[model samples]
Target: MKSTEPVCQYELKAARDAMEVIQGKWRIPIVISLTYGTKRFGEIHRDIPDISPKMLSQELKALEENKLITRTLHDSMPVTVEYALTPLGMSLRELLDELRNWGKHFRGEIVGK
Candidate 1:
């Protein structure tokens, strides 16, 4: 038996780039949390307590660079910053939802949960 499929180099590179953007340990969770609403750096840290500040900062920077998230600075008595999904990032919610459903389906089979 053999597989019959057409492979395009551009498609392959796009897939790899997409994976690279979301490949960090904390990226997915961070994205999921922010999907609900905008969050301050501290709020994101609290939501994902296992992630260190350094790691979270790094992940947020990477996501920003990938155009998946937007960082906004607010001017006030004291400066504040918030993170939110960009239009491009919001577009990924549907895909994430499907992935979540797939995980739910596989969890019991794989972990007896």
Candidate 2:
């Protein structure tokens, strides 16, 4: 049985806000990469094959702005930067795992594999 109550605007707006933050082909992938461990710019670019440097830079900025990831700078002979997921970002682990499980199930069902 389903409740007949209409969905509230607050609920819809919250969902939309979540979607807007992660909205982009690269944002999720970028977050996925950071899920493993901290990585430098090149490593992230290589991890997600075919993403141009410019795009990766842009997405990293967005994720950082959203407080999902932290960018750290190391000062050596030359500066190095690394990215790691924030606590907020790590909060998505369970969600990502669910997506992975569902994707595998869907693939098996649809592809008959």
Give the runs in model 1 whose Cα sits over 4 Å from its true position. 1-11
Clashing pairs in 1: none
Per-candidate TM-score against the hidden true structure: 0.86, 0.86
CA lDDT of every candidate:
0.91, 0.91
- Number of residue pairs clashing in candidate 1, backbone atoms closer than 3 angstroms, sequence gap of 3 or more or interchain: 0
As for candidate 2, its clashing pairs are none
Error of 1 at 29 (Å): 0.7
Error of 1 at 60 (Å): 0.6
Clash number for candidate 2: 0
User: Could you give me the TM-score of model 1 versus the true structure?
Assistant: 0.86
lDDT tens digits, residue span 36-85, model 2 = 89999999988898898998989999999999999999997689999999
